[model samples]
Target: MRYGTRALLSKALLSLLLMAACGAQAHFQELIPSTDILTAETGNTLALSLKFTHPMEQGPVMSMAAPRRFGVMGPRGQEDLIDRLRPGGTDGKRTFQATYRAELPGDYIFFVEPAPYWEPAEGVMIVHYTKVIVDAFGAEQGWDQEIGLPVEIIPLVRPYGLWTGNLFRGIVKQDGKPVPFAAVEVEWRNDGSVTPPSDPYITQVVKTDANGVFSYAMPRSGWWGFAALLEGDTPLKSPDGDSVPVEAGALMWVQVRDMR
Candidate 1:
């Protein structure tokens, strides 16, 4: 081949490569539940849809999960509920959807990953969480702090029958009294030692109820450490009405046994 022709071909190939890279980056255009608030009822399915810039390639494995490193903080700056993403609908188009039931009411967050063709086409995607308010009718009552009631998770024994794992719950309190509308987080550590809880195992967060209670269930059968945190913009008021700062990383430990 001529020298000039060879040089032109190399440049053209490089340009094509760059264009392909850019296209892949744009695949994830936006998340459907983009708003900071999501309203749903207890036992009702919450659908989270992801809109891509282009139609996703067929056979690409897409999955979603809650944030492994962080937990949801309630309005009082305390961890409230257990949050998780259950697999939902998969339409071979510019969008993908995941459905999760709103077990309780309060704020929550989820981390989603869309990987097409087994390659790291996209990095970690975070979907800002919103409040899921459940009413007596089992329907979303919209966002209203006046009638807002915190939701709690109650463990129903391991579904598998024989598994040793940790159980976690979120607690919201105000003036030494539990906050019913506060969010709670309970994380399970895979390692038996509980000096501090780390990552990998399933974590759940839930909001407290009018009575102030939230719970989380772990899948694995073993010893684990747990942490509870309550977070919110509103400063917690003391008995004297003094505002207090809310922070993360409040932790504790619990022993889970396999009775099955």
Candidate 2:
């Protein structure tokens, strides 16, 4: 009886550890544009979608509230786009969409600052500062422009028009200063074609150097998301009115094309 009880206790502890590891796996705030590189022939406008999810898992999407802030930084400068956001969804989960007319020949960086989300499993409030770049009319200038987000990834490589297998690098910044030795998570948007052989394959992790820069090479052609996570200095109130830590994430999305 003693041995049996010990075995049962061990199993319970292992199960709890597995559950925690799965919960810790990476939740991404996705802000993806309809197209990364927009040609003149494509159209005069762009459609952007926003969601919070585990991208590599293809999701059980976490419902997103209306963003706290939304805007675009382009050749002319930043413009408020909060009013343009429309309600959208998939699989019964609430999401957001925005349509913007591209009147300039330059790179447009679309950004979203989501409202704080309480994750019961993690016992923290999550706020992801998400952005994506769309190059318009063959004008590649301004892809690196900073939107002055609280936490952001300023791309060392142009965020759009990339081929698979190319190295992508970005600097993780908080309040315009590099966040040394930051942790960044990378995941590919699963299109239902690939499956992870193990749990670790779902979200790839990398750490920034002392200068707050990290790099990864894209192995497959698809939309890739990079999230640099930092703990906020201030705690927020949970749904239960308890004070909880805030997980502030800097997220960026970029699309890669196949050689074919």
Question: Model 1, range 1-260, lDDT digits (tens) per residue?
Answer: 99999767754553453334333422222233322333442234555544323212222323433323222233333342234333344554333445544345543333222321212232211122222221222222222222111211222222112235444444544334465644343333324343323321233445557776656565554422222233322334433454433222222233345666
Give the whole-model CA lDDT for all candidates, comma-separated: 0.35, 0.87
Relative to the unseen true structure, what is the C-alpha lDDT of residue 258 in candidate 2, on a scale of 0 to 100? Answer: 94
Quote the positional error of residue 81 for candidate 1 in Å: 32
Clash counts per candidate, in order, are: 26, 0
Candidate 2, residues 1-260, lDDT tens digits: the string is 69999767754553353345344667888888889888867986888889888899888798988899999999889999999999898889999998999998999999999999888877778899999999999989999988898899999998887999999999999989999987788999999999999888998888899999999999999999998878676779999999766778899999999988
State the displacement of the C-alpha of residue 208, model 1, in Å, after optimal TM-score superposition.
Answer: 1.4
Give candidate 2 regions above 4 Å deviation.
Answer: 1-23
In candidate 2, the residue pairs with backbone N, CA or C atoms under 3 Å apart (3 or more residues apart, or in different chains) clash, namely: none
In angstroms, the error of model 2 at 229 is 0.7
